[model samples]
Target: MGEEEVSNKQIILKDYVHGFPKESDFLLKTSSTIKLKLPYDSHDAVLVKNLYLSCDPYMLNRMREADASYPTPFTPGSPINGYGVSRVVDSSHTSFSKGDLIWGITGWEEYSLITDTSLLFKIQDADLPLSYYTGLLGMPGMTAYAGFYEVCSPKKGETVFVSAASGAVGQLVGQFAKLMGCYVVGSAGSKDKVDLLINKFGFDAAFNYKEEEDLNAALKRYFPDGIDIYFENVGGKMLDAVLLNMRLRGRIAVCGMISQYNLEEHEGVSNLFCLVIKRIRMEGFVVPDYYHLYPKFLELVLPHIRDGKLTYVEDIAQGLESGPAALVGLFSGRNVGKQVVAVAHE
Candidate 1:
């Protein structure tokens, strides 16, 4: 058992995609093999057996040709990599040891040889579901925390509007807003997701965006006094609608734009004048910028989780073979909540 070779199944991106991605866009190779141990001279490198993988909308951008913004696109012939929960099988780094549970950037394969340990974070509390690290306790959770408290600078009792409100980050934003005594409303693609927002996440109000013919009017009906904070997740038309409905001195934290990710030409928003007229402040944020506060964020959220003041939903697809479809489903709004691919039990 010292150094064993194992069959490694991997999900590889076939090529750069032009539009909405299909399952066929990925190539699943089951014949790959990886050693259970790191090389003798391997320094600062660790070999891990992946447990769970996150399927996020931003991965679509990474599937495109490398550009200034997406400089590190997935290599066509290599395994696709994203945030995942893994167990260390072998480690040459002092920070990690064998059998350590961690969540960070890892490959879309059964086993990953992580040479870059900069992003890796060890899981301190193994009692909490390890899969939560893929969503609620991992990158998406931090994104919501930073975007809401840090970027938006929300005040209690303020009215909040979150788009793509049932997804990973948006769902947490809604709950965080409610915990702050803010009136929170969310928009989702389906009625079931809308129900999840209102019933499950304690959103003040929720709506199915697909059923609404006019998004701007829909927002106006719900937010009579106007929105104080807008957690921007879906861009394009949704942004335009939210822009018109925003209150004076409103703050917009732009976390993601899932709606426009697959488009050849991103849809234009024609409401720039509203920002200046209303004296609104809108800023974009990346979670890494606030990674330093991870410990502090956990301190605030962990208690809520323990006390049942917060709830997180996840749509899990089983096996490494299901990875491609699960990743593609995110763009189409097929997933109910945070989409995760479960590769192994432990």
Candidate 2:
């Protein structure tokens, strides 16, 4: 596309979310003109052509008001921001050059002016599909690595349970746990996802959480011994049930609470008192805090991927226009794997 032909299509927030977000909550609009060149005097910034965008559960929290307790919310009528892989078209930044591929926080648009260039990391391994940066090679991958290794601190032969096991992060956590010689079990919402966990990701066992009449009983059935580490993805009832089945000095890494995200009021875990009885340790963490270790994470996961010892699955939406539906699908288990929207190709 020539400079004159460049145009920007953006997905904008329509309003603050009250309950579960719908497609109507966003408005897709196009700009009349999109400049391929960065402003001449601009310093430490790069203009990028966004290729793909990630749809993650954490983005749901940003749809609400900017409460003092949580991170800042998305501004209404503005383009929503998330992790994306992009190609630099113009640069006034020293660290990046034209045609360099990068990934980090970028707007949901065809083009974005990234002022904080430090946040973007240059893509070194183009041998892998660039879209991998949206999930397995990006934030979700880092989340699974840090949450499991740094937070949970697993040991061999330990029993680990992951909720939302077929989703991006949960799937990786389960695989990583298995590789560490742990007896790993995961719970997903559907029979198909359960099969993916066990058959594809090599989980020791998996069950459809929806079919279980009693979550505690289901946990006991899967881990007849006891859960030594729980990689929490869907909180609420699953967390409550897992609490009852934890071994002494168990570890819980609170990565996400997807079940509670869209509720009118967050559900409380009634069995949290089990933490005291079992001497369990529970902690919550964000992936960005561990960004410094990304290079190290790549060194570990990349080899596994190359050797076919690790597998990743993605559910891709075709264009920027599909971003709204893809994002809203996360809450309803509408996405089969890591949900991503392809905006443009380099």
Give model 1's TM-score versus the native structure. Answer: 0.98
TM-score of each: 0.98, 0.97
Model 1, position 339: C-alpha lDDT score: 97
What does candidate 2's lDDT look like per residue over 1-346, in tens digits? 4346577889999999999999999989986357788766889988899999999999999999866566568999999999999999889888999999999999999999899765688999989999999889999999999999999999998999999999999999999998899999999988889889989999999999889999999999988889999999888988999999999999999998999988887798899899899999999998889999999999999999999998999999989999999999998999998999999866
lDDT of each: 0.93, 0.91
User: Which structure among the candidates has the greatest lDDT?
Assistant: 1
**Total colliding residue pairs, candidate 2:** 0
Per-residue error for 39 in candidate 1, Å, reads 0.8
